[model samples]
Target: MNGKEALTPREFLRIADFFATNGYRLGPKIGEGTYSKVRIAERSNNGEFLAVKIIDKRIAKKSYVTKFLPRELEIAVLVKHPNVICTYEILHQGELVYIIMDYAERGDLLQLIQTCGGVSEKEAKRMFKEMAEAVKYLHNLGIAHRDLKCENILIMRDKRIALSDFGFSRLYLDQQHGDVTSKTYCGSRAYASPELLRGAPYDPRTNDVWSLGVILFIMICGKMPFDDRNLKLMLKKQMSEGVTVPETVKTQVSSECVRLVYQILDPNTDSRPGVVDILQSDWLN
Candidate 1:
């Protein structure tokens, strides 16, 4: 259906039927969102695993953006990279929309951080490198993963990282210069860039760098560098006072790494370094 159109009740039933025919044995719910619940599942033939993101068309049709679920699937399925969590199949039955994707057994980056009581200096750098590689791949495809928070970065069983969740991703035409200039404030408040919070034109790469900077800090410090009671205060702090890696962290990681973090999290997007700069940094390479 188009943005303005709605699916009928019969369409919803067909969507559910599609899943049953796909050989996906739905397991327990693993994640929940506004209109969907992600479930653990296995493909019947080879028993290869997958995560099934099932959304009720009825619930979505009545929600804001009523069309966001379908749009997200469309964009996600088009993006394929080794470091990116690939959307393998889409099953539309009745009023249900199902996205079957590779299952990351290790969960997300947040869980990995917690597993180590926060990552070590070496681990953080390695994680940063992997993340940079994935982001670079997306950028090359002319896609921007606007939401690059810890939760959106999944870790595979073998310890590799895969960027997931393309609900906020966008394709940047050459003329756009990679700017997320449109009025699209579409990510978690904690990781959002200043321009995003300020409601102005901004570059998505810089926005991603800002969030990655935060993740790097968290990985080393074992905590949020900026803690505020409210979103307003958080934005104020993020704008006025950029993160300062504690002296203790300096003992954990190199000065060059610290400098890299500061460069990325800089409140001003104009001065924020891009992924290329990060890849070229001694701390990264």
Candidate 2:
């Protein structure tokens, strides 16, 4: 059933009890957001771990559950790749919804960056390669992860990447149309494309590429290429200067990597490379 479907509190508890009986045991809270909190869970029989994201029904309704939760659930179930987070099942009650998903023990990329300053070139390349693969998989399926960013990328203990959070993602085209454009201005400002900031109907795939560029820059430099502190100046810089690899980065990062970032961050959306093209770039190789 779609997330919009309503259920009684008894139904919710019965489903939760059924999961508990099967093997699931809820553990400590692991993550939190404006609308939800994630908790660690374990399968008592096999010791397998899972992340359970619980969203309050009140908050979901206020935030337009029909617009996001259903869509996210749909995409989460449709996609299955090594580089993307896996959604196992969803359970709901009268007051909350629980989304069962794969748990990454090493936390997310944002936490990694904050803890390590910036990643070494070797580490950055490894992570970026996986991320590009994940994006390519989504694009090939006609989906656009509109809210891609560092915070949405989780890291396994082995350091492999798992792209998460599909709240702002959706299919961008139909069989009848080759490419469809969107006018929605969602996602973090620092990682937004120029067309999104300019308030235009833009290609979501290209928009995703621009955000990927921003993420790569952050991974290598430990800071955003565009800051939202000065909105007007940032927009002007985004429009004219595009991305600037600092001298420090030039000295430490490979030239090919820096060049790839520039190409992906091109102010003109049409100039940005698609996920497949980016995956085949020399830098990634």
Worst 10 residues of 2 by lDDT: 1-10
Residue-by-residue lDDT tens digits, candidate 1, 199-269: 87677877888888888888888887677458788788887777788897888788998888888889987
The true-versus-predicted C-alpha distance at residue 143 of model 1, in Å, is 1.3
Model-by-model lDDT, in order? 0.78, 0.85
Which candidate ranks first by lDDT, i.e. highest? 2
Quality of model 2 by C-alpha lDDT: 0.85
Off by over 4 Å in 2: 1-19, 61-63, 176-179
- Could you tell me the lDDT of residue 144 within candidate 1? 78
* lDDT by residue for model 2 (113-204), tens: 99999999999999999999999999989899999999999998777899998888988886686658987888888888888888888888
- In TM-score terms, candidate 1 sits at 0.88
